[model samples]
Target: MLLTIEDLTKTFPGTVALDGVCFDLRAGEVHALLGENGAGKSTLVKCLTGVHARDSGTIWLEGKEISPASTLEAQEAGIGTVYQEVNLLPNLTVAENLTFGRQPTRFGMVSGRKMRAEAEAMLAGYGLDHVNVTRELGTYSVAVQQIVAIARAVALSGKVLILDEPTASLDARETETLFQVVRGLRERGLGIVFISHFLDQVFEISDRLTVLRNGRHITTADTAGMDRLELIHHMLGHELEEAEGRRRHRQGGVERLQVRGLARRGKIEPFDLTVREGEVIGLAGLLGSGRTETADVLFGRTPPDRGDATDADGPIDLRTPRTAIAAGFGYAPEDRKTDGVIADLSVRENIALALQARRGWTKPIPRAEQRRLANDYIRRLDIRTPGAEKAVGDLSGGNQQKVVLARWLAMNPRFLILDEPTRGIDVGAHAEILKLIGELTAQGMSILLISSEFDELIAASDRVIVVRDRRHVSELVGEEIETGRIIDAIAAHENGEGAMTP
Candidate 1:
């Protein structure tokens, strides 16, 4: 084994983050660390990189016991970590960022020429020749910056590399490039620890997989022997019987929100859609297919250049989120941590935020009322937290998402737009949230759902609107919401072969 982790245990104040988790990595193999957001995957990575010392464990590197006490020590021992968020200095040039600490100086003077030559060679090796090494790293796209970060790590001659969701923001083409780089690294005998939410890519690149659920080791299996459903089942710890019994509702009733000739310059085209109460309308397409953009336009985050939304009351103009909310519309943005949650606020404060905003901050909800509302949502959504007083940031990713959802639900909006609300959450939490959506619709709420998971869209959505290249292409109604149909619609839209449809 290139690396062995035995009996690894880590605990926070009141939570056992990891429980006797064991894993092994071998040279020339791409080992995937599969788990839900709070399933101890991050904790295990932190422990291995010495960001958090394990409570109890034996970590062996190259057949010798090695317990790194600090991140620097781990790096010195041939371990490199690339986090989900790029960690390079934005202001520095690519060359400087690459060789910041290990720069080679001639006669005690910084050697710019030597650094540029080395950086250029590194970029060429990674199939990235267009980016200028002399330019500031931030001047390049996120994909290029990610490549530079990877090159810097590999240049350190690290025997093991841990990549945490490196392709989260990358498109398909960029992801293909990343896979090639990873494959080259594996061929060079570097053990890679890959973590991703994209299951298809995981199967494409991973040689072996180790799954974790609820902070415990679940199983380790060969990627070749596992199908997508089998992998999902293992991660969720559900039998085939339970998987088959998941019931999803269908669309019912007349249109509640109607958008006519919706257009956003350079973002989304003039498209029309009708969303009905007691139904889930899914927006389907690949990345950059204008799905999220449509959500933004509907929520008034990105105002439409030309459009009108109507109810039985007739056409209403939504120029801003405040207007949208006042008109009984609520939106749960895609990035919960950045756009949804208020990190410093307590759970009670976060849950009551939207309601408080609607009533003006000066007219604060009474302490008793706030606590009651918070407790109600906490119990209703099954959000795990110590109490209402706990900071929203202190909770797990899934819980944070629940807090965001509660913030919107507290307002009791007529139209709810959820943009990948369950992304990066656990299977149990995902099912719970999906079921909650169904329950809400049954109670007569209208929903516009956007998700990258095609299967999820097909299952939960009553109708799907497919978009491509900032234009609405086609609408998939009842009995036509299959994966193949969705893909074909997207393709037709991209090729400009379909008439704009609602």
Candidate 2:
């Protein structure tokens, strides 16, 4: 092993972020760090990068113990990291960026000619020699910028490279180009840490993988031997629960929401759906499969180019957020930090936000009423908070998510859409949120649920709607609902075959 970590542990206030995590990286292999959100993946990376001090651990590089007090020290010790977002100066030329602050100098002046010549040579090793080194980095695509960033990292610190979600913003062609560059680096014997949520890419690129759960390492093994299901099982710490009996769960009689040809070009293909009261429609798909797009269109976050939505009163506008709210629709978005929660606001304010929007701004809910509603739901939803005045951002991830749920539930929506509702929260909170969904549906509220976990989806949904490539493929109900069936529906290249339509 070129780099080894033994019994690494880190703790923060009220939580153990990492405990006895052990991992090793070989010189010429790609080691993937795999885990769901808040599974200590970030904490371990921070520890290695010296962003946080480890409580107890031993890190050895080439059989010598070295503790990096800061990122600069880590870079000096041959550890380099490239995050999802490119950090290089886009306005500068590729050559200038690669040699930033340390440009070749002659007679006490920077020499562009010297810098370009060296930078061109360095980028050549990363399969980017054809790119004009003198051109502004922004002139090229994001994929090109990433290659330039990697080249600069190797030029400064050559031993190890950490690629964090490198393909997130890339297209298939761009991802292939980046993968080629990574392969070249591996051939040259530099240990590479590949971190990504895309399981397909992990199996395609990583030589070995280490699964982390709840701040502890589960296992590390060669990628060739493990299938996607097995890898997910290891990361989730169990196999998905069988959905044998729940397929017969009956939907309420009243039709709550009706959609016909709802879609935006290049976002989602035209699709039709009917949500009866008390029904949970689970959207099953991999990332980029238009799950979020459907939710956005329904909630009026993105107005569809073409669609018709209706309630019992007949046609209603699906044109804006205000209309969606007026029509008794609520949404809890996937990225709670950005789209869902008002972090700076107090818990009471966050919970009262949707209601305020529903009721015109001039007619403010009284402070006494606000306090009572916030306190009532806080107790009802089990949101851990000191008081209604406490900042929602100060609470734990689970509590923040609960606050978002409380906001929608307070509005008493007829239809609710929850995208990745259980994400980034602890197991206990996840269960509570699921249970909350069950309670809501029991009260005859229609729900559109999106989750990566198949077990939860199968367990909660009356019918599973499968989407792929921005199109609805199939729908499953009754005895057809199961993890295996949903996986097949998601994986089925063409629609209809092996896909149960209702």
Q: What is the lDDT of residue 393 in candidate 2?
A: 70
lDDT of 2 by residue, 1-502 (tens): 8899999999876668899999899999999988755577767877998989999999998888879988778888988888766889999999889888553344136677887887888887667767999999999888889988998888777898998777755645678889999999999999999987667789999999999987899999999999878887887787644323243477557887789989888888888899999988999887778899988888889999997988899998878988988888988887675677888999999999889889989999998888999998888766766688988776655577788878888998999988877654544445556777777888988899998778778778898899888888889886688988988888888734632312
Q: Among these predicted structures, which one has the highest TM-score?
A: 1
Candidate 2 regions exceeding 4 Å error are 1-41, 52-72, 82-248, 346-352, 360-406, 423-432, 452-456, 482-502
lDDT of 1 by residue, 306-392 (tens): 878898888877778998898889998877746889989999999999999888889989999999999999887778787899888
What are the Cα lDDT values of the candidates?
0.83, 0.82
Model 2 TM-score is: 0.66
lDDT of 2: 0.82
Error of 2 at 357 (Å): 3.3
Supply candidate 2's per-residue lDDT for 119: 82
Predictions: Cα RMSD each: 3.3, 6.5
